[model samples]
Target: MLTALKLTAFGVVDESTLELGPGLTALTGETGAGKTMIVSGLGHLLGARADAGIVRRGAPRAVVEGRWEVGDGIAGRVREFGGDVDDGELVTLRQVSAQGRSRAVVGGAGVPVSTLADLVGEFATIHGQSGQIRLSNPDRQRELLDEHARPAELARYRADFAERRAAAHELAELESEAMARAREADMLRFGLDEIAAVDPLPGEDDALAAEQAKLMDLDELRELAAAAHEALSGNENDYDAMGVVGLTGTARKSMTRLSDRDEAAAPLTARATELAMLAADLAADVAGYIDDLVADPLRLEAVSGRRAALATLTRKYGATVDEVLAWAASGAARLAELDGSDSRIFELRDRIAGLDSSLAADAAAISAARHRAAGELAAAVKTELAALAMPHAELRFDVSDAQLGPHGADRIELLFSANPGSEPAPLGKVASGGELSRVRLALEVVLATGGEGHTFVFDEVDAGVGGAVGLEIGRRLQRLAEKSQVIVVTHLAQVAAFADAHFVVAKASDGQVTTSGVRSLTHDERAAELARMMGGESDSDSGLSHARDLLARAGRG
Candidate 1:
């Protein structure tokens, strides 16, 4: 519930402090009497966008502040906004500078405008003549019906719907994955075929290259080996002294003859003979080795073909036979896994189908709940309308299936039939401004009794209404005050007649400077004001008497 409101240099208001109570409080003045400015002030306090031009002329800034008795969710939200609040004593202040910068404060701490907006939103909702006209939007109409429904059933329906949506999303991604892997499966098969045909053994390509080199230069290699062997071993040459063993024998005999006088010649001769014998043995082995070096083209061609196949595999997979084999092993394993994935996907799809079917049932159940709630809502609104003097008007909630949204599967629209047999259209289409005001009044009446918000304020709900209809609007507003706080800004005397509290806004100036201020009008004062609204001059006997009579009839005893 709101405790107080203060405005300074805001719109047409120069300085005003309105002390409000728990019941319905009404504001009434003539057109251009700044009644709308009071609504704008409340909006500003609730974190609406501000323009510096709204400040009174020659004023530096516009200010609007409000104090609330936090109830229900408001206290929690106030603390969330960094205000330590107990029992809903929250002070929200907003100031807009002429330079276009605006500031907001909660509990004396400067805070962001959004913070204040969030806190105030928990306490009240401002349904303006333009934005967020409660009955004008289809979605809000649906939400109202849902709020009035069975809470446990709505919760179950919401949970089922969420599961259905999650399953649907998962099914979509799984199907996409299957398609992507199909391409991969083909590529893997192709690679495996190309590699399997090669049948490469590790290091086989290098071994083949060495074997081919040996076969290609077989004759040249054999010739070089034979020459080297011949140089090392020769049987015919230098056996004794130079030609063979005979020459070495002659040298040894000579050396032996000299050995009688000097022994060095005999040792030299024996060593020379041993070296000549080794050369002859090597020459014989060389002749044998040359015979084995003959070329075999058939074996050579086989080696070349084997090497080519290994090389192909190396180029396709990796630089070596081992790498190609590793790639084949991995690709085969993954392809097996991918093939098995299709079964799992099918299982998920089946499960998702089951959930989807269940979700529709759950949604239908929720829709059924709404239908029951809508009937109750219609009855309640009709009761409110009777109190509002539109006894013939019938309000109905048309509950039907709409597009699946975050909320649920049902769409509820508020329909009205002002007369019999006329097809009931939506609330916005059939109701006039005066009728709309009363309709809004009836809605507030219902929501108030339900204990929705801490405070409810109606601006210009008397737009096109007067007389008994206007008085009934006032009476209903006053009745709503019994539950929660209510505020109304109007020009209708009948509405003004039922105010638990009355405020009058008048433009006053001392020549050069002009300003607007508000004060609560007393009972005698209210009569004069009501009479003035009853089409009589202020202070006239007829006007004063009528104002008194109107209050008396409203049963303000």
Candidate 2:
């Protein structure tokens, strides 16, 4: 519940502090006395959008602060933002600079403005003139009925409805693009067939290239090997000409004779013996190479042809054999999906059909609930109307069959008849302004039943109403306040007479500036204010008499 509200440099309100408490509190004033500014300030404190124009003409910024007696839920949320809550109390502040910059603070810690908006709904509900206008909308009527009737069931129905709609849309799109998808499938299949015909293995392209290179240089390779072996050993057919083996053997004999005279020559003899054995091996290898060397042009041609086939795949698919293989794998997966689209279309049709059948049943069930709840809600509103000085008014929640939609398969309309013998018609066409005000109030009172220990603020709820209707509106607000805190901004003295706490917003001018301030009224002061609100001078003897009579009638004289 809101405990207090303070406004500084806001609108015509230069500085004002309104101390509030439980039960009905009324703020009343003359026209343009800034009664609505209080509600506007309250809105700012609850994270409404900022407007630099709301700042007083000479002030740089406008500030609004509210103190609340909160619960552990709100306290825990405040702590989540590293804020402190003293006992059960929390303070919220909003500031708007003349440059349109805004800031919000909750429990002394800075927070996003939306944070206050999210948390405010847990403790307060504000109804303003816009709410009255919204009541005439049929969609808003259906929403209100659903909120009161079966919120959980309707939520489930809406979820299924959304899923069914999505599936239907997907099915339609798939059917519409059937030709395009077929073309895509054909292109993919051609690619896949070309790849399959090549039957290229991973790394096969590189292996073929290496084998082809070796085959292309076969003659040169054989010649190079023969020459290298010859350099290491002379021709074996000319052994008498003394190849390296014969020469090294002769040198070893000389070194062996020298080693007999000197030990240092022994190492030279071992090296010469190793050189002679290597020379003998090399001469045998060179003779084998001369015998093994042969040219086969047919094998080389076949190798080159295979390399060309693999090259074709590499050019079309990837830069390498491995990459081409990867493309084939990826294309196969994509082709599978493309080929499966027809089956998926069938699956979607079945899915959408199943969901539609289920949603039909759900919508029927929701309509049934609305019908049942309609009777209860109408009866409740009728009772509230009777208390609000409309003893003969009839309000009906007309639920009729309609096409299935997000809300349900029922059309909800609020029908009203202000006279006893009149037939009820749609509320928008049949209700007068005053009747609408009373009816709107009645619905609010009925729907607001379970909001105990919370705060309800009403701005201009008594608009287009006066006399006994105003009195009854005041009475109902008082009754509502019995369970929850109620605050009303009104021009009706009859309504102001019923408040447990009354504050008068008065505008004053010092020749150059106009400012509004709110002051709590004493019993005597309340009478004077009420008299002034009743269109009579405060000091008039007759007005004072009537004001006192009104207060006494409210049991507060």
Candidate 3:
């Protein structure tokens, strides 16, 4: 709920501060007294477009500030934007410079103007002439009915509709790209077949390289093996030549005799025996290696051919045989997926079909609920219109089948008749400006039932209305304020009299310039203002007497 509004250098309002309270607060003045300026200031404070022209003549800028008793929904949003909110109280400021620049502040922190707009929208609704026109829109009509009827069902249906749309879109793309998918699958299959034919094994490439190197240097390898064998054991062709084994045997026999005479020599004898045994083992292994070192040209040719084959596989699929094997594994897996595209497409189609059936059922339920609510809403609004002095006014909701949409499969339109004999027609066709205002108020009153803690600002919603009709508008507004905060900008004395609080906008002029200011009225002051609103002299006894009677009727005297 709005608690206060302050304006400075804004249009004709040079400086004004309004202290607001619960229930209804009426703002009134003469046609040129700048009541519109108050509405403009409130609009700017709530994040409306700022026009530099709104700045008072010769002023640098126009500033609009407002305070609201907000709930956690708004308070949490303020904090999200790094603003400060104290004890559920929120402050907003909008400043428009004469140079066409604008600035907005919320809860003492700077923010984007839209942020302020969104936060205020959660708790406050501003209805003016434009809002009346908006009511004529078919979509808005549907929204009103949904708000009155089947909100939960509509939400669920929309969710399902969204899911169905996404699935259908995917299915379309998959079907359209069937040829591309098939081409990809063929490419993968060919690559897999090529890799499979090579039949490469892990580490096979490295093993083959080593074997080829050995074959290339077959003579050198054999000579090296022969030398190692002769070093470990004496050559049979040179019987007199001693090698490591013969020398260690001679040393062991000498150490054994010395060790028998002296104990220190015993350790040398054991070392000689160990050296001789190691030399014998080395000699036997070298002989075996020499025997196996025969060079065969046929084996060399075969190893070279096999290495070339492995190289071809590596060049195409990987850098080595192991990498080639890895690619084949991954390729097989991908081929399987590509091969399964038909099944996947089939599955998607089945899922989409199932969702379509489910959505149809959901839409039917929503349509049924809307039809039921259409009657209830029409009845409720009709009753409200009766109280608003539209005794012959009739309202009806026309719910008809439409193609399934995100909202549902129902199209809702409001039909109205202002007299008993006239056939109801679309709201825009039949209702005049005054009738629209009452109808708008009636719909709001019905929809806003139990909507506590919300603020409703009606900018001359009672425009083009007067007399007892105006009084009825005021009574309904007061009734609306029973559950929400209501602020009305009205010129009607009857409406002004019903206000729990009243403010009057008055203008003054010097020889060169004019400015307006607003002030809350005392009980006696309200009487004088109401008299002026009734087109009578403020000091006239008859006007004052009538104003007092209005206040008494409004229960505000």
Residue-level lDDT of model 2, residues 1-557, one tens digit each, is: 89989999999999999999999999998889999999998887667789999999979999999999999989999999988899999999899999999999999999888987787767888888888888889998997787678645687889988998888888898899989989988887887798899888888877878877877787898888877665666566877656566687788889889999999889988998888888888778877876665676887798788888888888988999889889889988988887888999999988888888888888888888898889999999999898878899999989999999988898889899999999999998989888888888998888887789989999999999889888888888999999999999998999989999999999999999999999999999999999999999999999999999999988789
| Candidate 3 minimal-lDDT segment of 10 residues | 150-159
Query: Candidate 1, TM-score vs. the true structure?
Result: 0.65
Candidate 2 at 298: error in angstroms? 4.3
**Model 1 worst lDDT run, 10 consecutive residues:** 240-249
Give all TM-scores, in the order shown: 0.65, 0.82, 0.72
| RMSD list, candidates in order | 10.8, 4.6, 6.5
Candidate 2 off by > 4 Å: 14-16, 44-52, 55-64, 73-86, 90-118, 221-298, 339-347, 508-515, 539-542
lDDT of 1 by residue, 213-270 (tens): 9999998898798657545543345453243334444556676577667776767656
Q: lDDT of each model, Cα atoms only?
A: 0.77, 0.88, 0.87
The prediction achieving the highest lDDT against the true structure is 2
TM-score of 2: 0.82
Model 3, 85-192: lDDT tens per residue?
899899999999999799999999998888878877778887777879988999989988988884566677778788888878878888898899889888878877
